[model samples]
Every structure is written in C-alpha cells, then in structure tokens.
Target: MATTNVALQPKRGRPSLARASAIDRVILERARDMFFADGFDAVAMEQVAAAVGISKGTLYARHASKEALFTAVTLDMIAQHSTEAARFDHLLTDDIEQRLRHHARMMVNSLVQPDVRSFQRALSTVQHRFPDLAASISEVGYRYMVRIMRDDIIAAAARDDIPVRDAEGVALMIVSAIGGYQLYETSTGKLTHEELQAHAERTIDIAMAARSSW
Candidate 1:
C-alpha cells in the first residue's frame, strides 16, 4: 500500500474568498450610486463604505483608491446594461416591427433608471478630468452599444423578417436615429417619456422599412 502522506492540508478558503468578493461588489454598487447622485468630487471613500455598511479599510482593501472604485463602478454599469440587453436578445421574435418595438422599450427602460441617468450625468461632469475613466466608459458603454445593435440587426436579417441590406450599416443608422431622438429630449425641451418611446418605435420602424430591397 502506498503510504499516502496527507501532509498538512492547505487551508481551502475559496468559499470565504467568494463571499468577500460578493461583499465587495455590493459595496462598489452602493458607492457608485452615491457617487453618481452626489458627484465624484463631493463623495468620499469613507462615505461610500459607510453607505454599504462596510468599513473604509475594507473598501480600500477591495479598491486601492477612489479613482479605481470609480472606474470599477462605470464598468459595473456597462456590465449591467449588457446583462439587460442579453435578456432582450433572447426575446427576439420573428416580427421585425415587434422586435424593434421591444428594443425601443428596453432602451427607454435603461435610460429611465435613476442610477443609470445619474451615472450618465456624473460621467459627463468628470470625463474631462480623468481620461482613462472616460476611455473605459467609452469602450465599455459606447462601443458595447454599437456592437450589440449591429449583432441584433444581423439576427433580424437571419430571421428573414427585417430586410436589411447591410446589417452593420443599418444598425448604425438605427442607432443614429434613436440617438437623435434622445438628444432632442436632453437638449431641446421636456418630452414626455411616453412620447420618446413612441418616437423611437416609429423611427426604428421607418428605418427597417427602408431595407425593403434586401
């Protein structure tokens, strides 16, 4: 019989590590909410930790600095969006108009989230101060938006309902249309949220209709 020397078993702390990471994520999300509402310059790391019912030392252990935390928060926001978008992607139907409508509704839902709206405003305020933060936001948020839209268009083409000539280009055009509508609301005047949703649906419908020549 081979002498199985089960020498001093190393401590297995994987569960503890996982639990700690989960706590850190919760802290980061709470901190992100406070920072967005109060502005990054006004918020402190201690305050963030306190908001999450954690100690500043614990927060620091997870995130080396305020800047790092801020960056992580932005990345988290993008991750949340991607998760939401994936849900919509799975709900895609054979009806092109219905799919467009669903997408429009989901977009409105995302924009109307209090935290998301605050995050966008906060980003606009400090993007100039931290270039890396701004770049990360751009790559995660903006770039992800473009890629998701493009992929959705491709899927629509495969479904054979939406006659898209060039799925990628058409996706960009759809994005541009939706973006223009959003800009009008943000800049010009107070458009009812319902009106914005309706406008987005119609705009998307018209754009998809243009691909009749598929």
Candidate 2:
C-alpha cells in the first residue's frame, strides 16, 4: 500500500537557448576583430575572453570553438549585407541597369571591410586544415551572393527588363564576374577606396551590357 503512493517524475523540457543581444553582439564584434587582426590560427580563446574582459570558460560558454566563432562572423556579415540589399529594394529604380549598378557597388563596399578582408585571407591559408570552414564560408558568403543575384535576375525577368534564356546561368555568371574582380584586386594589391569604387562601377556597366545584349 505504501509503494502505491510513489509520485511520477516530471518530464524534462527543452533547454532554452541564449539569443544574440546588443551586449552579446558587442562581444562577438570584438572577438571578430581579434580573430581578423591575428588570424584564426593565431588567436586564442583566452585572448578573445581577455579582449572582452571575460574568462576562457565564459567565452567557451558563449561559443563552442574558434570555428563556431568564425561561423557566427560569417552569418553576421551575411545578415549585414542582406539588410543593405533590402534597402535597394525600396529605392529600386525603373532602370534594370541602375539596379545592377547598385548591387555591384554594394558588393565592392562589402569586400573592403577590414574584417571581411582578413577573414577571406585567413580562409585561404587554413582552408586545407579546416575544409569545413571554407565550405561554411562559401555557403554563407559566395553561395548566398549567388542566390541573391539569381533573385535579382528573376525579378528583372518578371519586369521584362532583362531577356534571359536561363536565369540561373546568368545569375551565376554575374556572381562569378564580381568574385573574379575581387580576386584580381586582392591579388594585385589594395586599391584606394575611390579606385575600387570606380572599378566596380565600370565592371557592373560592362556586365550589364552583356546581360542586356544576351
């Protein structure tokens, strides 16, 4: 009779996740700076923690590993770019060429960010060791760019502004052109900000001409 009085155990609920906030974002931004300045391989977890006035354990609690931190940075960069791209949607002009030019300008501006430049350089160095990092970066960076370009192409087609036999192919080519331009610039040397802007504008004009002609 006494054994029959045993109570049932309560079911466990899922653990709550920590959401990114202004304070957390500040910490992550500082971490990204350290990672960029020192390269991912050189920066240590303790360094990141010390930079943010936190302990190693605290940093680990926030981010599981250096790779995770890099992933967060990639995602953050993508989100920032997405927001910038969204603004163009509101101010989109009737001219398809104008839209293409705006997009090109955005792409050039994005690559010039000191942190972005560092991340890309670091990626090239450690891609062999951390293949996943490269893949993740590509997925979040290059792949995302391609998708956005594709959407823009589709939108232009919807408006009858650009004639495309294969919208996806055209979009891929557009992204490739931009990527090629960035790679070339990075390889040669750093161009002055104004020079880079001019180059992007010129490139966009040429690509758009080809697109329209096709």
TM-score on alpha carbons, each prediction: 0.74, 0.77
Q: Which residue pairs in model 2 clash with each other?
A: none
Q: In model 1, how large is the Cα lDDT of residue 51?
A: 65
Superposed model 2: Cα runs more than 4 Å off: 1-23, 161-163, 212-214
- The stretch of ten residues in a row with the least summed lDDT in candidate 1 is 1-10
**Model 1, runs deviating above 4 Å:** 1-15, 53-55, 95-97, 155-166, 187-189, 212-214
Candidate 2, residues 44-111: lDDT per residue as tens digits? 77777666655677568878988888777767867886686667677777566777777767777777
Q: Write the per-residue lDDT of candidate 1 for residues 1-214, one digit (tens) a residue.
A: 1121122122354336656666766766677767877898898888877666656786798899988999998888778876876775777776766766676676666665657667867777888989998988877765555576677667867876545667667666666676667755765546567877887788777876776753
Go through the candidates in order and give each one's C-alpha lDDT.
Answer: 0.70, 0.69
For model 1, how big is the CA root-mean-square deviation?
9.5
Model 1 Cα displacement at 21 (Å)?
A: 3.4
TM-score computed on alpha carbons, candidate 1: 0.74
